[model samples]
Target: MKTIPTLSLALIGALSLSACQDKTAAPEDIRPVRYAVAGGNAETGGARYAGEIRARNETQLAFRVGGKVVAKLVNSGEHVKKGQPLARLDPSDYQLDLAAKQAQLAAAQSDLAQQQLNLKRYHELLAKQFISQAQVDAQQNGVNAAQAKANQARAVLDASRNQTGYATLTADADGVVSQMQAEPGLVVAAGQPVARLSQDGAREVAIQVPENALEAVRAASSLRVTLWKGGAPLPGKLRELAADADPATRTYPARIALPGDSHGLQLGMTADVALPAQASRQLSLPLTAILDLQGKHYVWVVDDKTLRVSRKAVEVGAIDSDNAAIASGVRAGDKIVTAGVHLLHEQQRVKLLGQ
Candidate 1:
């Protein structure tokens, strides 16, 4: 009787232990996942683009006359004032040309004086009946020819002097020499670029946009420009955009004009521009939260009360690298599974993490 009672107790205990194990194992099938509340308001569409700081006005300075670059007065990156001499040409040739012109003018003036004296003598002779009218007329014509030659030589001399002045390259505006193309001993022609001047004040940024995004970029409501070195964001406005795409880059070039005091900005400094997209306000979610099935997009949204997930169809708009712009079907404040979404099903029981 004692053995029978002990055996019965052991069997009952085993049955009770199995029952407890079954109770604990039943809930293990419910998977735990990380969930985030989709409670953010529709974000303003925006994108970032890389660009470089530039001057609002850039000028290429060159010499007006052709000559050997005998002297480079300013180095690259040197600041210059308006009318400052930037470079000089070999003035030896110009001086010689000027001397020749002056000599021609002087000779012509002397000839004119001689012709006037001859004309006076011929008139006297003609008055005395010593010379023919044709002879006096020839003297008058000689005087006129000498006078015209003198005037022509004088004009040529003036042009030669101007050319001499042009031998010295001067800055047309107050700016910094951003580049130098000619050095000492290099002969450059007239209108050949010798230096690049970046005009002072009113800086801008040069950026390029792809064909697909060019229109949106141009239509941005506002722009914020930030330097790569990091500083307070600077306000910028679109000054102009390229009419056609660049052949090599196939991108439209753009310029953003910066206003106010941009103290720390410098030429050629890399920058980033933020432009708001003109598209309508839309909700954006992580790309991983989206699931594709049979060509349709779906997302796992959880009920706030039951913690059960349901598959909801979503109208996807723009798909960026990391996020998808949801156009419809998913409302704000809905709990969505960002990770491990593919493993979930409709009405599937799930344990919420970070509750």
Candidate 2:
């Protein structure tokens, strides 16, 4: 065989090196990934939340002024009518105050009478030219001043009488006492709640709904309330829903108005609220598909055509052990990585495990 030229050998070596690099570069490393299709969540019968029976209007009865409680007229659970006295504070100080105000009024009235006589005498003297116009004018002004002082004293006396009346705590409306915080010999401050009065009117069931279930509660078609003592469910309607969630419980307070004659549903009684399942057209995913970072949650979504995955932020609600209901983010029919999500990365090539 004839030996190849050195230049030809160099050319063949370069071609082989180029072929090896091309082969390595053309074959990409593809990862196998498992995914599941997201769709609308299933509807259960209803979501049950614990709640309590309450009155439509429950008022806290507090004293308008601070004083030592002298007597408690009503016991807990006692029925009271409008303007009925429930408790009494020591009225000795208030009595003294009223007496002093009356005394001041009397003194003012006496001074006004004397000033009126002086003014009349000055006017007569002016008519006869016995006094100058300036003297008469000054006496008239003094009389006006005395009359103003008398009016002020009368107003103060009326206010003092009102204060004395405040010493007796009376019910503003017909209601039943639910609680009593202060008793005889106990000193209470102004605006301190002495009792809780449940007004005799419409009744309701108070329920605390979690943040995730708040919308469901609001969208509920109907509600059923069952007493904890094992009675038939009573039909209830949504009366009020809190605009904000409680900071500590992260739950919204909702009130369901019960029938006026909801038998056996008394105030402060425990009850169970049942909200029927709501139909939703939003997609849901397994909790394992989501990754929580910082304070937000995200998911790995797959591209159907490209077989690649990208990180997507998602808004989740009402998470259970296996799945989480999606409020926003991924839509219906979107494929999400269900397993080995943490091992995946953004914009990474992937191949379906069963494909």
**Clash pairs for candidate 2:** none
RMSD of each predicted structure: 6.2, 11.9
lDDT tens per residue, model 2, 257-320: 8876745667788988888655555466777888888999988888989988999999987554
Q: Each model's TM-score, in the order given?
A: 0.76, 0.67
lDDT of each: 0.86, 0.86
| Model 1: CA > 4 A from native | 1-33, 37-39, 277-281, 288-315, 319-322, 328-334, 340-355
Error of 1 at 251 (Å): 1.9
